[model samples]
Target chain A: MTDQALGKPEADRPAKGPLIYRQAVLTRITHWVWAIALFFMLLSGLQIWNAHPALYVGQQSGFEFDNAILRIGAENTPEGPRGFTTVFGQKFDTTGVLGMSELRGTTNFVGFPGWATIPSFRDLATGRVVHFFFAWILVGALGIWAISSLLNGHLWRDVILKPRDFRELPRDIWDHARLKFHHGRSYSPLQKFAYFGVFFVLFPLIILTGLAMSPTMDAGWPWLIDLFGGRQTARTIHFLVMVLLVLFFVIHIAMVLLAGPINELRSMITGYYRTSPGTDASLPLEGRERGRGRSGGRREIPTPDSSPQGGGEQAGANRQEKSK
Target chain B: MSGLILNRRRLIGLGAASAGSLVLAGCDQFDFLGQRNDPVRDFLERANSLTYAAQRALVGQQALAREFSESEIRQGQRPNGSTDPRQNVAEYRTLEANGFAGYKLRITGLVETPKEYSLAELQNMPSRTQITRHDCVEGWSCIAKWTGVPLGRLLDEAKVKPGAKFIVYHCYDVMGGGLSKPEPYYESSDLIDAYHPQTIAAYGLNGGALPVENGAPIRIRIERALGYKQPKYVHTIEVADGFSQYGLGQGGYWEDHGYDWYGGI
Candidate 1:
């Protein structure tokens, strides 16, 4: 087949059909699940990471007034009982009456709002419960995605870098530097590389670093700490990975805005997509279309130009696409 | 909008723009994780003992945790470790029923006088109160008012042996004796932490007699270490130079299960 034969034609495209089949129900569900997991992990982790309460620890430098106040309150309330004893002995005439005036004073109260305080979330027992549960969900879903993707051949087919991708990578880099993709097609090769880096490397790093910090998990899998350096080092890496996750999330949203928001959003939620038909049709079928074009295999991603097929096939295809 | 469709060209541009921020964030660790070992880790471990030596030169052992107002105290301050006293429950219950008239703390191991004192006798001695933050290894912390006698005074009264460098608290919550892993529930601290001004044999919390859940008659209030170090329902005191034979040789029950022995952080 000539290159032009496989290439999408300019004008013979269908007026409307499916744009692209980049996402499905499984992808949508997993993405949202991953997003929420990242959300709680960031917030709860920040609460513990709070070395300086005045400004975010992620920021440069700030006065640590809360630490000072806590120190003073700790000193006088429980340690400085001489004053309490003297007052109690002279005024109350009873040793039973305890003094605790310093603890209640407003000077000691730290200033985040009540909503930010989330009492249930602050409890150690509660925090542990939530962390463990969400951690399991995040791990379980990722495990399924990884295993199924490998079994379905999507891992090698879509994500893994092929010889052609490697050869084209430098041109992608130069093009990216020159901002040559200003009116580019779907995704520039460099953009694809960034997406692949996040999905394959950074996300896994966050998960592994988190597991390394868990004492029970570390005991069972001591090599995890060795892999990261030590417990403290693991904690530092886990925190930094979270910062990366946040950065990626921000960039991803910005990218969606820069691209066609409706098209991107629809592609993620529903499997069907309407593309500039003629030029792209033959390209999507290099492997799968060979002996199975009767079911309109590539054309089968969306609802037919005629009638709806089994919802089961559509659902199964959605899951298969996500595993990709 | 088709206009937002960056094609391949615009997408590459956006990707290059983001790479700079990623590089900056990645390179940040070099400052915090420098070359040599952190001196802060060692300094914190030696805080209790070194602070005492420094105090001797200037303040002469006067540093203490402050006492608090009665009204500001927590109504039912939650207990951290070993809340309900087991093993000696019947005996302790009998003592509590009789207002602890016969109950006495035995100070015997490696001591000159080998003294035994009733609760009333302990109350006769000088008392100290301190409101200090009880930092837990699991990342929660709370400030509580503790009233008790300074541990140094008690050790002085008992006349600790020359070889004793650490105070091992043998609690009433017994871990079965054997080479086979015994169920661990008690904890101990070094003599430096033992003699700390904040370290006390606490008899009261929030101005009242220590509640049963809060260790009732007495418990070690080692403020510097994690909450688990504060052993409740303390039965006997043993002073030892080494912990090689002590409870699986891990210092504490939880320490045997991978918790840090010096949980100073």
Candidate 2:
């Protein structure tokens, strides 16, 4: 090959990395399809969750109202300590109700009064409509993706970690911490762990929880409620899982920003990954150091300016220091 | 010309592909974030009438949700929401004590007949039994076999006036001694649902006395609606022109709160 073709660098021109193809068109499409489907599911799920909004540590039922006072006409006025009630010649404690009532007073539902809100309120009927319609769409897309990925060997090459992948995990973790790696290659173990968890655990949990909410389905599939520890619990878990999925999406977007934007963007968009020569398959060994690997800091950030051998210097230094 | 056209084609192809992917990516965002009614929302609002018309057109007014065998009945079916109804419990208990011999359900409002009948008289007229689920808005459910005369029969007997368009059930539960904004438990449904074959004025559960907590004497079971619309301890069934100008002017008591007026869930 000509010198210019092998690794081009000219005056006023940036050095070029090796051409690498990682994801196939199908993989890219399916990955993005899953992402979009998840977005709809999360937002609609949030609106439904807002109806029975959850509360944090000290909040009371996630609602607010004033403490109700009872005037018993002097014969049974609340006496003794704070938040105590007296009823018909006997005194009783009402500390719990008082605190809950006070909390309820301040943090009520947003917008107009409760009376005018019923017809206009966002009803479950609407939520259920969106939920079921999109649910079928998601299922159809997922089915097509699963079949396509299996027919291709993309599942094997991309998802299943190879023996070498396992062996290099610790080094990869160190490399990732120092931001020394590049894209257009396999994902690290931590990423695989999260991806697998989302696919196997979280997605399935949401699907099952959605099924458990149906009354007609419940008649035929009562066991779904038992499996999810009852209907309300399933609803709560569905909401919690949705929050986790949204958090995952936020973190994923942040990572895309931190990594070299153009390089990362090209890989996701075009199914072709352009990597620096050091991280490229042509010079793979140059990217990893021997004994100093775990201690030698490395990261997965892509090289800027399209340099082919960008990370070689730091990698070489780590190798020599470990060998000595 | 060929080379230039080929370059342009490739550019267009790539742009089309990118735009397609971007559209697909943003599709779900548009779906979730936007507040728009779906086909099912339309379907739910119209399902009662459609189901009614379909039954009339096809099954000749005899269609119903399938009934199950005796052994299929569940055990310990919870009372669901508003279980221990707070209004007129003493009145209900007094009837329950006497096995409801003195109990009568009065049918009035926008009806030509406006007749009140004893529980035995209502039970004797063309009964139907179906086991269906009570889906609560609070996210609990229970299956119970209900046997009663279709509300249509009672309404027909009462001869609902022409202008009458809805049936409002006055139930026996006042919430938090009127603290709950939607106090005085009650529910209502359109004429389409009020006449559905499955809709019944149920007086028995699991083939025994209607327990006090479970709306003794009678209750309206609008099966497709949520549990709160079931309207336990149904004292009177009134056909009205519209829910506005009724109690609190928002249909049923629960509907006055955040619950949907047509809770066909």
Candidate 3:
């Protein structure tokens, strides 16, 4: 709302949109909780991975088995002991990182350096303890979020991709590829797809594979081993899922920065968002030709359960309905 | 415009790298949470029992670990954690040298009848052969054939007392036991794992005698737990009401060193 923050000319100031509350209180709270919990889970997870620096694709793996798909270790060469990482039989020098790195004052050979782990030391016991505790926190938070989202119809309205959403997919993808973004009240097709994939696909896959690696779970759910092929294979999938989640996280943050960081941050933090100005609140149909209607301010994001007229959230919904 | 775009891309890449390194370095400052005596860790670690209880509910007591066929026994089990125990090497060698004729596994503590069995007696008793996966806490697994008497048979013969809640396995290995002290390596199991059909006192692996590298002569296997929970080079099994008298009173060697006592996960 400040002209200085916009850094635009007097002509552009006329297009500055009103700030409407687009995120709910629950959304803001859960978002921060997940941020903290994920930070702990990711680091502690790496700590556990450091214990066994190799990944195999079958039920059993050891000196006698040759099915390792990834292995990180240090080997002695004519030059000296050098750190190397092998993936699918091809090896790469990963010195000063991955296989070997300096910790504190001394360089030592380790799957991942001390700093990457929870304890900042090579202690599997501590790493597992840390990993499991935070794991519970994540599972619990996700459970609460899912139930709350379902009850409030947030799952259906925002996250679930409707048939119309598919029609916008190509356009959304093209806009994203070119660094263009649409500032709207509801989530765009891309955001819906990303959030849906994260919540419904990636998160469940990771948790399921993690449980499959447990001997007790395997005993109780005998079919779990068959589902993933084997315990070792489950572990491999668990590792792969972690990598994908990291990829998602990196892209997510990059998009936030590329899009409008302050506006985005304020929405998630205070439930307020600035829709790009076009249609006036009093004259919504004036900008209908632009296919983007604007409105005054609303205090909360629209839940499909709540349908009040004239509110910004309702205005966005009505505009979307007409477009469809 | 092209040059500016390239510069922006390079800037983003550098930003990501520095942010990553900063996070890695920050973990060192947060190591206090990992400190053994820290209250924060102790509070967080209380979740271990919750997980144990949850998994116990999910996996009932009688559920059996998946058994593999003889053909699935692909390799010799990986030897880990006290492959060569620090203590009782001479005594262990004497037992091995004489074909283990002199070896006697002692069953004592809260049992109604304390008993000692020679290697021959254990072999002669009822036996179970299982080709099961050996899962390590470090996250690798190996499959091999294990032939030995079920541990429950020996516990029944000894007659565990009503109050006895766990069985502590004292091994010949001294893990991190100081040079002057030489504390033996040990692990304990509750009755649920104790009576599981696949929980056996393995004396043979891959259809051959158990190799010294893999707890030769005898090692008890609790099939539903990780490798560390299965202590190797065992010489005694003590029935106990609680872990108060064991190494640091935490149930197992690794448990005392900050591992969760429940190994089901």
Interface RMSD after interface superposition, each candidate:
19.0, 11.6, 7.7
Give the better candidate number (1 or 2) by DockQ: 2
- Model 3 docking tier (incorrect/acceptable/medium/high): acceptable
TM-score of 3: 0.87
How well does candidate 2 match the true structure in TM-score terms?
0.52
Name the runs in model 3 displaced over 4 angstroms: A1-12, A278-324, B1-25, B86-88, B177-181
Greater lDDT among 1 and 2 belongs to: 2
Q: Which scores better on lDDT, 2 or 3? A: 3
The 0-to-1 C-alpha lDDT of every candidate, in the order given, reads 0.53, 0.57, 0.79
| Model 2: residue A193 alpha-carbon error in angstroms | 1.9
TM-score of chain A of 2: 0.60
lDDT of 3 by residue, B1-265 (tens): 2353345446546655675676656788668876787998898899999999999888889999999988887776878877864245677777777888898899999888899998889888888999899899989888888999999989998999999899999988776545556567899999889888899989988988888889978899999998889888889999989997887889998888889898987
lDDT of 1 at B114: 80
DockQ of each: 0.03, 0.09, 0.43
Cα lDDT tens digits, model 2, B19-91, are 5575455333333223434453444334334333432343322333334456545453456456665343576
> Candidate 1: which stretches are off by over 4 Å?
A1-18, A51-125, A170-188, A276-279, A282-324, B1-265
For model 1, residues B1-265, the per-residue Cα lDDT tens digits are 2233434336545544564453344322212212113353223223333323432343223333333345434334655655665444577777777876877887767788887778888888899887654545554344568888888888889999999877777666545445654464657676767897778888988778888777878888876555777877776777778666777676777655434454443
Best by lDDT: 3
